[model samples]
Target: MFCKAFRVKSHTALKSSDRKKLRGDISSTFPSLTTEKLAELMPPKEDLTIAKVFVHKGDAVSIYVHNRNPIIFELARNFYPTVYTLWRHPDLLPVFTTWPPVFERMSGGADLMLPGILMSSFGLPEVQQGTLCAITLVGNRAPVAIGVATMSTKDMLASGMKGKGFNILHTYKDQLWAYGDESCPPNIPPEEIEVAPSANLEEGYLDSESPAYITELENLHLEEVSATVQQESGEIKLSTETFQEEKAEIPYVENCNTSLQETMDDLLHQCFFHALKYKVKKSDLPLLTSAFLRNFLFACCPEGQQVDIKKSSYKKLSKFLQAMQQRNILQVKELSKGVESIVEIQWKHPDVISFVAPETVLPLETCETSDGGRKQPYQPPEILSLYGINAKMLPLFQASGHRKGDLLTANDVRSVIITYVKTNELVHSDNKNFVTVDPVICDCLLNASEKHDLLLLKWDDLVTRCLERMQPSHRVAFPGSSPVVRKGNIEAIDISVAQRGSNKKVTIIKNLELYGLDPVSVGSLLQQRVQASFSCTVLPGTKDRVQVQIQGNQVSQTGKLLLEHFKIPRKYINGLDLAGKAGKKK
Candidate 1:
């Protein structure tokens, strides 16, 4: 749940009474923790702070932070240890081991699948549904993730290990880990050593009772399996045979530089096409080359791979772009001295048309992990649509040196209307709250009914009428970019309940792209959080425009996600009132 950054609602030092109670709660939550260990984890003199925070999905949690690391969190009145707590005490909870690749996927916000788990002769640990557990990587005992069991051990075995094993709540390298000093998980060895998994078992099969398996390896122990298995300095040494087998799988590299250069070039092309296809939007055109490379290209590089232009054949990003330009892929122009921007891209170029993206590209949301992780998703600049001075109001605005079509915010409109009233001496002497209706006020700020019924109007009513008479317009501005003034209101995120088939309801959300949200990422997040299936499809007749369809009536969840997590203004969200009591019940 904390994979996303949370907003700290309140932070305060822990009281003495609360400290003692917290220690007791920790002791009770994990019976494995001893008094001494608990004391070390939570010292009396060390100032602990209770941080009441809310995650993107609107869940309120209280976290106990020590040395800037969140050690424990309280959710729904139950206490759970953070990965920091598990790092110091590795054996505090039952751990399910998985492959290293699976850990990266989990950190990217995926549940632990049963097939990815590594099992031993002793079989999986016994845990009931909702029982909290830790996840470790193969050959290392350090816990990398924290989750809860999706089903009982008996149910997992009954299903033949074919579905989601755990619902991962937090993982290493996620926002929760970014909350602390961002330390990596230290390698820790298991207390007891098990024999290396056999080739068949590594392929995800366990035939323990088979006659052939029993005859080949019965009652196998580490020493009996191979004399090469040994313990040195508290670390287990793998069997020589196993080491040789793994070594054989790796291809030999003749020269390190040649291999590195080829790898870097591959990364460049992969990220280049990936960025143009998914990252760049028409609104982001005339994008700076440096910003494109630093923000988009590098972000698309696969995990554990760094993109270095110097290592590639081009030796420079500009050279690579020059090569692409020669191939008719895109055009670059130097708009200012010593600075270049990508002017145009040929969308129908064969290279662009046939560029199939990789299945796993690092999402831009968590791409800033190399830097300090973001506290929340990217918030597009706030755009406001308000009244503009029109032909009818031009005569009144001329005295204030305002143009005929100047855009005005609510406050600006009020200020101008008030100034006009005061300058014309339209305020009634007896009642200062009212303004006398003159010819200009009648033409520009009065309705037919008000003009016929009264000679005077309330100050607020006059301002409201003046604003209603103005033209509609919008303003958009962000750091380092020119402000844009348009004549129409910006489109809001559209959400509506639609019937898929007979009696089947689905929530259709569109216009998220306008707000810098990826339709696929948002759909995946909701699918995991709501435990519902979702699909994304391009809008017909529109290229690059997509909509997300989620099963069931999930209007409330969608609203909270957009409003709280993404920091979107309520005014920019449409159809929230459609989230009836039924949606809340879900």
Candidate 2:
């Protein structure tokens, strides 16, 4: 069961009688479970709750302790009675052991494959198919995953221990584990766990299985099954067939520098023409420049290929679109500064009208490989010395016991202001929002008029002016990457579309508060402008600010509304370049 969805379902507290019945059920499911052990583990009282949760393809009721940690549960149709038993206590249940690598795979939502299982020296667990089993790692002996056996032990041996052996229900480190307090598996050394000699009988058995082994085994199996065909076939035919299949599936480009440039050019050309002919429609014209580039043009690039504008002959997407306009293929117009929108298109442009896409066009390959072999190691950005702090601002730092030559970071400046405010008891008694600015703070931070008169300043304004006075220092050390420097007093706005249930798109607009805009008012305006459903959801960890979400791909309409109606500057909206284009109706 995925833990995230389980947490979302409505949980109701179990009644006293119901809790008693549940205790009885658990004892019946696990016969060895004693009354004393059950009392310690599953307490009868104290707010026990149950929620019907969807587990994989089936429904299961999750029993939670104090509506927090999900300890035990049973799937639909009883599912072999309590399909999973959690390891919240230190007791050995019927556990099947595997290697550490397999434990990692199971944690990542992968089923336990037969090949990943490590049989005990004595024999595999004598369990029937669909039996609930605990999967423990070889070294740790601590159960990491719980699931139902897909095959009986006899059936597993008969089939050579191949295919999926366990259908994992819940695993450690999964979403469910994240819901409760962060609890980790106990650390048990390999020497502590007992194993029979037969466990060590298979050579290299303990070593993690590789993808190459699966491929080799498949080829060997194929050869054995079709011995006659293999004898008749030449090595050239087999090799060529394999190469052709690989090429058809994976578009590989030559690694040579010269070929790289040419290949990129061809790939861009292919993507441009393909998008223009198939993806873009005349009805969808008057599209926002950001929306067109992000959703249509950029999305057209072959999967796995990095869409770098520098690699193309044109250095910018706008320049490339302008080139297309010059060729009479389309037309572009500047609506505002740095904001361009497509105004016209030549539906019957000669080149586009007669174009026929190649049946087997190879996609452009990326510089890095799937195995991350050619990837470059991460290099931290260079730290450069900033300009030294001004002498006039020295008192602000000095008042806080900071020496004249003491180096101050952006955080240090804020700290000094906070310390000064708290020490002087400047905060208003009734309303803490107001800070009574003293003559010392006024002289060092505020303007001349403000210093002349005693004034009540907002806490945020005090912090902002404090940061503004400190100049960048010349001496530099690589303590860490410098904080992001805001270009202006106004914060940048961002608009992005996220996929929701069943591929439905929701466009999210953030940082409206930065522009002194009310999220509720903006949300209302969006609904009116687009004539679509929209809502204002409060952003987490923020006081009153919220994010505006509009249903479907509404970036084009949202940008137009912001620019023409809202009068928001083009530069302030940061992620318009990532706005999605509206999909063509079928």
Query: Highest lDDT, which number?
Result: 1
The residue-by-residue lDDT of candidate 2 on 219-335, one tens digit each, is 644333211101111111122233224434431111122533466567667767777887788888788876776556654655334345555677677888888888988889987
Worst 10 residues of 1 by lDDT: 250-259
Query: Per-prediction TM-score, please?
Result: 0.44, 0.35
State the C-alpha lDDT per candidate. Answer: 0.73, 0.58
Candidate 1 residues lying further than 4 Å off, grouped into runs, are: 196-199, 202-387, 390-476, 480-586
